[model samples]
Target: MTALEIKEYIQKNGKIPYVLESIGCSNIVYHDNKDYYSCSNAVGGDCNNPAAINIRNNKYLNYRNYTRGVEYDDGKDLISLVQYNKNIDFANAMKYLHKLLGLKNLYKVKEEKKKPDDSWFVFSRFVVKRRKCVVNDFDPMSEDILNDFVPYIHIDLFREGIIKRTIKKFGLGYSYRWRRTIFPIRYWLDGTLMGYNARSSIENCSEFGISKYFITPGMRKEINIYGLWENYKDIQKAGYIVIFEAEKSVLKRDSRMDPTGGAIEGHVLSDEQVRIILGIGVEEVIIAMDNDVPIEEVWNMCEKFYGLRKVSYIRDKWKLLGPKDSPADAPNKIYNFLFKWRIPYDESKHREYLKSLKKNS
Candidate 1:
């Protein structure tokens, strides 16, 4: 689609039945070997195929991409992008997120000025070396890796397929809050298959009160967001993303949060993650954390990096609907409040909103 055609051709999918259908969401369950993914029906597949989302060399944290100033995927809690690169700033941010997550040095990589046609910096780690999912229509993994490399207790959204069945056939699997059969998998931003994060189900983890859900030995939440690369543009266009506390938030129909794993919700940003934000060249960053604890502390942190001018907050009004630990008490209600944000970014409106919250509190 041409740049002009995007406004018309930018296809969109409204609510569809959550089932495996090629016409719907390219559903299947089986691997094609040669590192190509094996897919299956979620009804018969393992819990969910865990694609090895190799930030490969990049890094991530809480789902926000700093380098390109965009959110990556639609799922809110995914690992950094391994397969495809979207939004240059986001891909670049993931690289630094990797570093920030302690997957690499603390420094986020600096963005260099380049032509649009220049090698998209996001692909540098794998494109030149031909790592998994870097090649289009080329599956570069083994069934063993597909079945034994990924862990999903932290990152939830699963892709549909047989791998998802494998988990359920035996009685255990995390359904992708969004997307398809999870098993070990990977893909590019254009939605091409890249690689998978396959893993063994937690066969015996109840003793420590640990759910039997299996996870890789070393996947770190401090290191990456689950599916950031997929939703980079929306984040940029939206100018801000509403961070959620749980990975499941990405799957459920909650407008207050990013179903794409792009929102940044947590206690605070690490120094490295903070630095990653600068790397992206973002002029504004509105901290939209849930009003769980000290908004003041969070405010201090925001001021440290983005300044009071760029910060914004969504006062936790979970009580507006009912008593609970979620905005789910009234998802639509919360969403309606945020919907007004879709308009252009105006300073006066943000101030009014903030002042109103302060008076109410």
Candidate 2:
């Protein structure tokens, strides 16, 4: 059946929770008053502390497997939930759902329409030529372009424990027109201007329909590592690197943790980023994502550098961090303590430790 038909069928029949159970999800518990059901994460198996995954009104699914750094905050439909949990493409997921529901996998057919003709193109000389449009690649911006922003520091950075020296060191700027703080993104190997990340300074900016971050068009934050330009030497000298989620986390740390760098955009590292880190020749990799990120997710990141480098991670097992706090968000002593006691990544040991914590709790 078509995607919409399958979705409607599941919701109308109240089969979302049943689908979860069918897909190997265990410990399914429904909340009578809230009209929702909670279950252990489908991917990680049943947890003594269940509720990492939930379904609301049998239509929307919310799954947060922090250990895996996988979260579906916005509710997902049954098809999407199946696709994600089962690691299958849309067609296969639909087919699986059909099988589970005891239905046939009959796809909807499209109405016939006139097709475009591409046999030949009339040119000035009556030649059969198909013109190909070549898109231009974006060139790197220059440091001189930063002159556009005012050379003034915003108070928000300071409130976040960013010192004046670090601000000036990074050449932070302010945009008068946009009312935002400007952060210049640069190439890591050689300091060349790449783009600017403009952060909204206005309080409750989202309420006013202003986005928190406005990055430069054509800027691929995924491929590059922020602060790598400034901290590459430190990372090499220290024999390890600490990877954080946000750029500010890299700037707010003790200068000693100069080896720390931020993932330009997200908690997950891209293939190119992993390659770059491997090329850096560091002996150890410390995945120090934010507190909200589960150790399981961090452990998954460790797989990238599994045998190539010694992998370790910082987790708030002692309850030092807030719900969404970064290790760098804490004071120097706390950050240092967490860093010093970072757990070395061992698949078997980590799983056992997680089980132990669940058992004790």
Candidate 3:
């Protein structure tokens, strides 16, 4: 079974109490009214706080260490809980979780039933017209609310080479309680406050099975393109906009004074996003999604801008990026290479590229 498959299986079949015990959480106490169990802190040390750890919904876990105040695991998976308490990476944690579940070796475990392929192209076609479902008016949040968060930059982001100027320019904040770097999201057209995108600050957070981003509830991210509120004028002036998969990529480009927009999701662009991008009146669009996205799917994303505007996409054909690294995720040289050599989207060329990928694989 794959890591995702094993994680899903654990969620479906694993029990909360057993998982807690396996991870060294003693004195587990269930709260009947709240539907959560309090246990000895396996995370961040107990300090004799018998019920320091709280497990809720059998999936999410939080702990309040005496010194740390309160911290929640962003990953919100059973394996993430294990990973935290055991001080192990995701793969080792998965192996431990499999043992606790009495499952076979991680690789040897077999699925009882075959699962459907959930690739982006499989559903993107159907959801093309569903873009009208976006809600226009959201309850506005005060900009002053950002004052409640510290302007502390996480070490991981610093390691990513995000400097103070770019961080301040975007109004990024750090929440000690949630342990996430906060991105205040606003309306793309008018800069009206919409909500916030809280991202985990932990190093290798996604690999450790932590939820990478947690947007405010009911915030429709797909309808809004990040950086538009800040860079629309620049985008229009440049006559082109580079579209990245995440906000960090946009920030990376911004530090270089390169105007960009972020889909804030994956490679798939929503119709509303297309509308927003086209509305920017840029003559050209550059798609710079992560390296792992299938070539055909990248072309499908480019298909959204066909004919109306010049659309190109950056791919690591020169072997500059890691398997899943985005163009902006790398140093300037790697990023410059991919961006400078972006291929103009053409149906025939897209097909040829697809054939080459298949042949090479």
Candidate 4:
């Protein structure tokens, strides 16, 4: 009869006849691919169309099907579209049935449909209107380095002589990256375990690891902020972050990857993502860079981060970087560049940033 009625019928009889098509009921699609409609964003077939906002947005599109969010759901079967073969966890069941009934599709556009253009460089080349873009090239050294390794896991950080020499001096579980870098990813308030930071140990290497990605894991939007998992005290005393290209650069006493990235690294942080990070309550940012890029690039980056707060750069921090420029290369020097600079932020700069974003967008 209606979207809500169809849901009720299915809930009551465990099935709804084909007449449910008006309210948008179609077969549940399930496959092993990662694109499985396993989340609310992947809400299945009867998804609402903004153009036809008054109608139900079923997971299924009649003539033009979007396979992006299809998956099987026969009574909570996440992997196959069979009815009630077995009981599944609440989370798994919700993920599966959400795709089957396609309840979540009404809220928004599909992710792939909203993706930015494939043209242009992956991160910073495009304009983002909100705050300065924190998106940067994965590896922005002046030149390219050999990057031919990919492992789901790594063990070099724990080799025999390496950990011993450092552990005896720094303490057990002291964070380090690459060959000789270490940073503060430990407890801040009492005994709470904050994550550790480390950098790769190689000279002129653009990427320290298999991927030069930023990760503040164990953080879910419902639970925690990205950069503020714990150790807010250190973050508070510091006033704001000296946003570097990598996670390794947070601690003044730690090593940061891409210290020379400056503005070239896409240091602009969006107001939405920033508001969440700042909601943890830090004031502003002091972007640090390495000698790998030009000063104008850094200024361009600052232009993107317009609305949040003031941003400044460390003068000679990029110059101090060693051959590899990872935290493991020269831990202390990395910290020197981060703490030495601070700038105030104003929102006006965001106008050009937003305009550029819209044009390129």
Clashes of each: 95, 4, 2, 44
The alpha-carbon lDDT assigned to residue 11 of candidate 2 equals 72
User: How does model 3 score by TM-score?
Assistant: 0.57
- Cα lDDT tens digits for candidate 2, 60-154: 34444544465544323456567767877444675687788876433322323334544442111111111111111123553555666787668
Q: Which of candidates 3 and 4 reaches a greater TM-score?
A: 3
lDDT (CA) per prediction: 0.34, 0.67, 0.68, 0.34
Candidate 2, position 31, lDDT: 88
lDDT of 1 by residue, 14-129 (tens): 11111113112223332334322222212222314333221111122113333334454322222222212332454443343333334333223332333243243321222222
lDDT tens per residue, model 3, 1-361: 3344454465466466787887877788878898767777654465367766666644234333333354444323455567667877444675576677766432231212323544633222112211222223334454555766898667778777777888887888888866788877867755766677778877787897777777666666777788787876777778888888888888877776666655556667886677567545577999988888887777877877776678998988888789988888877777778778889997777677668668778
For each candidate, what TM-score against the reference? 0.39, 0.58, 0.57, 0.33
> Model 4, range 148-192, lDDT digits (tens) per residue?
112212244443123343332223232222332333232211222
Estimate candidate 2's alpha-carbon lDDT, on a 0 to 1 scale. 0.67
Candidate 1 or 2, higher TM-score? 2
Candidates 2 and 4, the one with greater TM-score: 2
Q: After aligning candidate 2 to the native by TM-score, how far in Å is the CA of 326 from where it should be?
A: 0.9
Name the lDDT value of residue 346 in candidate 3: 78
CA lDDT, candidate 3, residue 302: 81
List of clashing residue pairs for candidate 3: 75-210, 75-211
Instruction: Output the lDDT of residue 103, model 1.
Output: 34
